[model samples]
Target: MNNVDLELDLNNLKMIFEDLHFNNEIQPEQIPNLDLYMDQVITLFESNLFETKRSVEDKLLTKTMINNYTKDKLLMAAKKKKYTRDHVILMIIIYNLKQSLAINDIKNVLKPIVEKIENNEKVDIDSLYNKYLLIKTNNSEEIKASAEQKLKEVKDEDGDVLLYILSIIDMANGYRKIAEKLIDKFFENTNEK
Candidate 1:
């Protein structure tokens, strides 16, 4: 790639990062304190997460997906057919994690939290979700910096885009592997008992 092309690409990349809008994440305060029905939950997610969809036709949350999640034990069953704030929070977490992790892996990672919610333990789920949002805010800058650094380091030779893409894939695969291994080491046995 020529210097002009590189500069343009970097500018485009920065623009994309700026568009991420960390505040776009669903806030704990935004969730209704009162319980919600399935259709309500679906509407809430669709309205809140419309931007996260890659396509207008994509469904963020569906009745079938929620039913399957409950059936698979990834989510707690609704009480009297109504879902709580905790359930909404968990579904958001699950939706994000599902993008990069296997369903079983997500279940393993979330099992303890699910148990706490289901058992009516004083888990302070709002605080936990806030912490996650804080971490997400922190990581966004780190990710942007890393991407900028990688772009600078990438050769200006032909196939620069391909090289950059491969680098990103390699990094993502590495993190996914580490996460899966950690889940295996710490959580694989949780399901045993």
Candidate 2:
């Protein structure tokens, strides 16, 4: 076999060992069934059971309906399994922000809010509402006031796109919070240079 193929095989074996070790730690009795589970996982992978990808244009079209600039961001988040429902709700807020604010400005405003939501911590919605007011007024309040309104109004033609966008947003928020905690930890441990 070529070096690349050998490397790939070695990596696969390492992964199998790791899974076995993890299962042994969690439930030793399950060791006997490990081969069966591995077969299932291999079959699922080969069958494209976890395949999920959306075209950039498709994601953009989805965001366009919502009037948000979060298409690319949401796509990346979804790819990483970090998107969720609340993140989608937050994207509605972002759509309003995009009407008047620059992309960077909108991201700055959303970073903290998304972080809080991902961490399962309380967020100051009033403050966020006020921030939204500073960015855009029209449709902003409506979006914030009724989080589920647009979702309900979404028709069958656009339902899947909307739902996918929402899932991506949710994941993005989760990843954002995880990233924030890691950064905070780094800063906490770092001595001023």
Candidate 3:
């Protein structure tokens, strides 16, 4: 592409990064305390997490997915066809983690807490979810800053879009690898006991 075209492309990419506003995390307080039916749970996720979708047709949660999560033991079974607040909490965690982790890995990660919830024991999942949101918010800022810096470098170097993409892919792959490694270290063997 020509210099002007390349500059425009870079500018568009920078704009894309600048436009990433991630304030859609569902707070625990926002979830209804009353038990929700399947459709209601789906509606809650769809309404609260529409921004997280890459396309209008993309669903944040589906009945099939919820069924499969329960089948796979990634989620606990609902009582009397109704899901509780803890169920919503687990669903939110599953939705986020599924982006980067496999189903089995997610089940492994959530196993202990799932057990606690299933056993009618007190669980502090809200605290954990809140803490996760805090970290995610902090990381969103860092990611925006990093993207701006990288985009500037790429533009200054005559718009090396390939290099910029490669760097992003590398960072994502590295994080995924670390997450997998931690799961292996802490959770993989837990099921065997």
Candidate 4:
């Protein structure tokens, strides 16, 4: 159930236990309610603990996977103390794209976009893809057309960057869903605070 419901249930249990203890004349039938309330509280606590543990485990796994994947692409060449959602999203996208493109090629293609993002400039995927194709390949027109088509196929949402990255990676590795799940868990944990 929700947090409010869980809190109300726990409070009710405490009140009932206190009342029962204060009045020893309470019947054995009344004891059943206390037992039931205690059981519900325990169950809720266990469920919450399990969810929390699972979320932490999922986050840790995602961190490790992304670290290995982006070891060569990190700007500082050092392990990050904290990774933003954008960073994880980018890593997921790059990991997926690496299936068809070499790591160095992918880095070259993404360097400009990453630089723009770091400078707080709006990134235009279509423009970046076109420029990358023009600079790196002989068939610029054909590559630009294909990349544009792929970019157009991606659905834009509130978190378009994350979705775009996940979609690209998923197209290549089918592990986008797991990354999405981890992202959701990450946000959920943040909201709990």
RMSD of each: 2.9, 21.9, 2.6, 24.5
lDDT of 4 by residue, 49-102 (tens): 233332434332234444454565422122235443344335434633544555
lDDT of each: 0.83, 0.40, 0.84, 0.41
Q: What's model 2's TM-score?
A: 0.27
Better candidate number, 2 or 3, judged by lDDT: 3
TM-scores vs. true structure, each candidate:
0.89, 0.27, 0.88, 0.28
Residues 15-117 of candidate 2: C-alpha lDDT, one tens digit per residue: 5434432211111221232232223322322333112213223221142433233443321133133333344335445543444454554555566565566
**Candidate 3 lDDT (Cα, 0 to 1):** 0.84
Per-residue error (Å), model 2, residue 124: 7.0
The worst-scoring run of ten residues by lDDT in candidate 2 lies at 22-31
Q: What is the lDDT of candidate 4?
A: 0.41
Best of the two (1, 4) by TM-score = 1
In terms of lDDT, which candidate is strongest? 3
lDDT-wise, the better of 2 and 4 is: 4
Candidate 3 per-residue lDDT, tens place, 107-150, comes to: 99998888888898999888888999999889887876777777
User: What does the lDDT read for residue 156 in candidate 4?
Assistant: 29
Ranked by TM-score, the better of candidates 2 and 3 is 3
Candidate 1 structure, TM-score to reference: 0.89
